[model samples]
Target: MIQQYGSGEPVRLFTAGLHGDEWETTSRLLEQLSPPRTGTLLLMPKVSDNEYLSTLDRDYYTTYAPHLLRAIKTYRPTIYLELHSYSKESYAALTGDGRFERYGVPAYIDIEAGILMGSVSPRIRKDFFTPNDLCVSFEMPKGPNEQSLSVICSLLDVVKECWSRQGFVAYMSRHYPQQTAVAVKNYLRFYGHLY
Candidate 1:
């Protein structure tokens, strides 16, 4: 079973580590935990931690996806975001389309990159989402390129604010503080749209 938090009008579901090796994403999510009863953000961490021990390089798609599928079917959340880490690339959000959707929400590869470039700082040049749109996985910077603590906090704040106001029925990248803006850029790039 998975864990959850918050429970009000707008439900923000944040998850980490479908793939256990993706420690950066896991660390980040773990660090941001608030009390569950706040009824706002629902967090599910290490969804695949035990399964990954034997599976190795495999992500959550095989072992843990069924649980997620069931939850989405049951709860019907406003948005569902699965987080992961890639050491090589920058960051991305996964959409469900296959680079062919008209609305471009599902399987829309590099949608995050597109959104961030239009609304974020120039320092972040590259990022991509899986095209699923439901999830946002990211690649931490290599060497000295890591974002600052202030920047991370800012990004989280923007995500909370934007999701709260607009809801997830539609796609929109709202305003964020300058420091937090980079995480938005990174999230868009990392979550490119997967199933």
Candidate 2:
């Protein structure tokens, strides 16, 4: 259910398979990850087998996965990265510049990495982690691909190297100014804080 690797502060939690349909792809991505050299990496390859529970729906997860809730409270992760998938049809809506957005937060397309990333809302963060913790979700197009896999690995490296809130923000701000802003706004809008 939950596998932990490495050790120390700034614990990072990676979860996949909150929804049954997307579990296969998400879990595969999780499998590719190696343990971090520093800090703890908590991997939950399958959060729930019930196709009904979704991270987007707060009540579904809260009601169906008490064990997950327990794990979060027990571990107190510094960063929670939820892996999910999207349909090809919805790709434009996610990455488009139009006002219509599926996730409420601005999504960015890393053309070279072939991944779409957005911040999970503060509502979800509040339910699972402290206000200062970083919570984000990465969506791929319904399958495991090399580019996305590499990007996810790179993310873990960043988390391991920059294991503090301030350090992580500085890294993002220096390299990914736009995405950093979107993430900050997404967190701040809903009683989320980074201190």
Candidate 3:
């Protein structure tokens, strides 16, 4: 299902659960959905909600692509972040830094068009749609943990910068800053530090 929130120029689309059992993105999006978001946010938590456990192939998910495609055409979003999970090796290859510490720290956000290889939703088939839009396919470990917060936080950092460039920002005035600060404080406290 498609759910929308916020209002402004340069609509943003956030999609998750394209691959079966990959639920981190969906969870995070649902967690942060209630407060009035900044800019246009379109969320499709589960593209193939029915086949979530029975398949991982792109074709299976593509069967339901027309629905999202129609939304894209209608919303004309200028940004997209398709979230998914992948293997640790997949993460290493993307970074090429040989770091296997599955903390979901640094996410891959510079996925170029057409070259479908590593993690995340791989390539969302938005054919000829939002060509100039800022697109990213983010990935996490198959067995996600609390580290997923780091990934989400990092994504927020990037999105803030990118959105600012396009005159689009999320939750700037709605205690979003305080929420982020609290998250940081909580993280520090969890790690046994005071901030």
Candidate 4:
């Protein structure tokens, strides 16, 4: 289901629970969110009922939950934040010594917050939303824990602050230069344009 709060431009959409098993923590996080000070916040706490939609495959969402896809298209959010979780065992694969390093997963460790932040790759974003829209995905270690919840909350605050002042892409490009460059290059290489 979707719950909307606040109003105006730069509509931000937050979706969790695309995979049934990983829904709990993200759903709880979305449930506790307060109304934004400016612009609209569209929260979809549960996006799918299929446990098998376990991967970040856009096709699964399009096929299984067409209504959710329809909702996203209709809303046309300026920022789409998709929340998900990974098992503790899988966390190693995503970090320093793992797939992130070898495969360039477009993820970074937020030194100040002590959490890993993952942004949608340009290739994936091309399939899901316009280049101008910022699409991010945060994958917490599975289960409910204080640190994970706090990190997400802090990230939310950062997202809001950046959106209000300098815009998400600008702020991200300033701080996360490498990831931003990779995203831009990938977008340009594959799509032949940034906008």
| TM-score against truth, every candidate | 0.49, 0.78, 0.56, 0.75
lDDT of 4 by residue, 70-89 (tens): 77778877688877777767
Off by over 4 Å in 2: 93-112, 190-195
Task: Give all candidates' CA lDDT scores.
Answer: 0.40, 0.69, 0.50, 0.66
lDDT by residue (54-147, candidate 1, tens digit) is 1111333334455644555556555445444444333333232342233222232232222221111111111222132233332222221334
- Best by the lDDT measure: 2
**Residue 121 in model 4: shift from native, Å?**
6.4
Query: Quick one: RMSD of model 3?
Result: 12.0
True lDDT of residue 2, candidate 4:
87
For model 3, residues 1-195, the per-residue Cα lDDT tens digits are 788777886577777676556664354554465523457777877665454532224554346566766766778777766666666666545554332244322223223221111222323423434334555455555655665645554554455335632332244223345433443332233322311
Error of 2 at 119 (Å): 2.4
Cα lDDT tens digits for candidate 2, 130-180: 656777677776764777777766765676555766777788788778777
Q: Tell me which of candidates 2 and 4 scores higher on lDDT.
A: 2
lDDT of 4 at 40: 86
- Best TM-score among the predictions, by candidate number: 2
Task: Quote the RMSD, in angstroms, for model 4.
Answer: 4.0
